[model samples]
Target: MTDPSQPEDTDPDAEDGFYVLHLFVTGASLHSTRAIANLKQICESYIPGKYSLEVIDVYQQKALAEQEQLIALPLLIKRMPLPERRLVGDLSNTEKVLTGLGLSR
Candidate 1:
């Protein structure tokens, strides 16, 4: 009952699909800058093109922040791949952040 011409699906969580992350930052503060750098490093080293990151500055878009129920200055929301997750602060903890985003090895 399988098509020989089609490639086999090898990913275990392929059904879950990729992830979309929304990073909420208050301003161009140190924490926000660090969060962006750290997140970029992690994603590039581990997940690569498996996810997408959308950075939103609350200082510029306070209404969007309020809509997402953001109460912290730097918050990362994993919006896709099922079982949404949130992480607050500068995102310095690589393991914790990766685990939260379901990208940990």
Candidate 2:
């Protein structure tokens, strides 16, 4: 379903549509590092050039973390393509991450 708050042109079904994703992680944590790699792999394989990923280390950017209300060690936020979504974990499950980001396998 399309989110009413989003612009009509922002179609989630469009293969060429752009996506803005923010990944927040705690500094130096193994899980955080893994999440970053997993997220990057998923984005490259799935969205390719149609997505922008921003990896933010909460330890370095504490203000951003607090502003985004990040309560998890590794958090992924889909900021674009309509209704926002979030997934928190090591991001090892590719299928789950894809689904959470509203993408198909």
Which is the leading candidate under lDDT? 2
Per residue, candidate 1 scores C-alpha lDDT tens digits across 1-105 of 666643343333633477788999968899999999999998788777888999999989978988998777699998886567889999999999877777655
> Which tens-of-lDDT digit does each residue in 49-101 have in candidate 2?
99999999988998989999877779999888766888999999999987777
Each candidate structure's TM-score, on Cα atoms with residue i matched to residue i, is 0.82, 0.84
**Cα deviation of 84, candidate 2, in Å:** 0.5
Candidate 2 clashing pairs? none
Q: Which candidate achieves the best TM-score against the true structure?
A: 2
- CA lDDT for candidate 2: 0.84
Stretches of candidate 1 exceeding 4 Å from the true structure: 1-16
